[model samples]
Target: MQAFLQQLPALIGVVIGALASFAATSAAERSRWRRTQSVRWDERRLTAYAEYASAVKKVISLSVRIAAHRGIHPDIDALPPEEGLPALAAAEEERTVKWETVLLLGTGSTVVAARAWHESAFRLQRIASGREVELSWSEAIDAVSKARRRFYEAAKADIGIALGDVPESYDWQISRLIAADSTPPERNT
Candidate 1:
């Protein structure tokens, strides 16, 4: 009886040690699971952001082409209204479909930014279609560009990226202009 009583403290210490180890392991596993889930969701949100941006850009591009037809962009080759309108409609439809995914996966700020971008893009479309003449092409383009920058900023922040500010780049437009100017005119034989 004395021997058993003396050994009781040792047995109790073993049980406590085992319980502590179990608790620590459980907590670590739970933390790991939570981290993995967070990463997976972040990846999904990033993909949604990218796809939505691509869709919106397609709509904007078509609108720009249509606007060029109306002599809004002197540097760009004009796409006739008959050809531009149908393609614009198709691009807008794709943007709408991509918007649903953004709504589902994006954070609040990101979703708001996405909405702003699309709304601006819609305004650009209206300008191209001659539905809204109050806003000039350059004004519409600036609005869309600003909204796009905001959306990208929100998306980057949501995904834990630390990009300070997205710089405004109109290099593509400048390059296009330069290329157009450099092209040699074809001579009639």
Candidate 2:
């Protein structure tokens, strides 16, 4: 009985030390897992922002072509919004395959603005080719033009933030990130 009593304190200490080690290991593993997940989400969000921006820019380029047809955009007449919308929608879906990525890493405002702008573009496209034209061809074209410009500007800014990249349209963001003697942030990252 005396021997057992004397060993009790050492046993308790061993048990406590083992428990503490297990807890520390568990915590470290959990932290590593979370960091990995965050990195993946960040990559996905950057892709979405870039891809969505690309899709929107394509639409905008189409708008420029259409405007040129109407003497609005400079020397551009390669637009067919009716055919463009489907492809753009497909692109958007593909780009946003992982929703949580966008929700967690990308800015919600950019998504919201992009959705609204797409809806507006779709409406204009319906006017261009649908059961009936709710708006005149000129009005529809004008609407598309405005939406495209807005989309381009917003995308440029947001994509810059998301991927540490600059939008093609935003000269300032590009300049800001350009290293006088170093590579750009996106390239470096």
Off by over 4 Å in 2: 76-110, 120-189
- Reference-based lDDT, each prediction: 0.81, 0.52
Residue-level lDDT tens digits of model 2 in 1-189: 999999999999999999999999999999999989877765776676666666655554454444333333233234454554565456445444533344455566766666666666555444433326566444554454555455555544654443344334444322332222132112210
| TM-score of each predicted structure versus truth | 0.86, 0.53
| Per-prediction backbone clash count | 0, 0
* Per-residue lDDT over 26-61 for candidate 1, one digit per residue giving the tens place of the 0 to 100 score: 999999999999999999999999999999998888
Query: What would the TM-score be for candidate 2 when compared with the true structure?
Result: 0.53
**Residue 16 C-alpha lDDT in model 1:** 100
Clashing pairs in 2: none
Cα distance off (Å), candidate 1, residue 156: 0.7
> Model 2, residue 129: displacement in angstroms?
8.9
Prediction 1 TM-score vs. true: 0.86
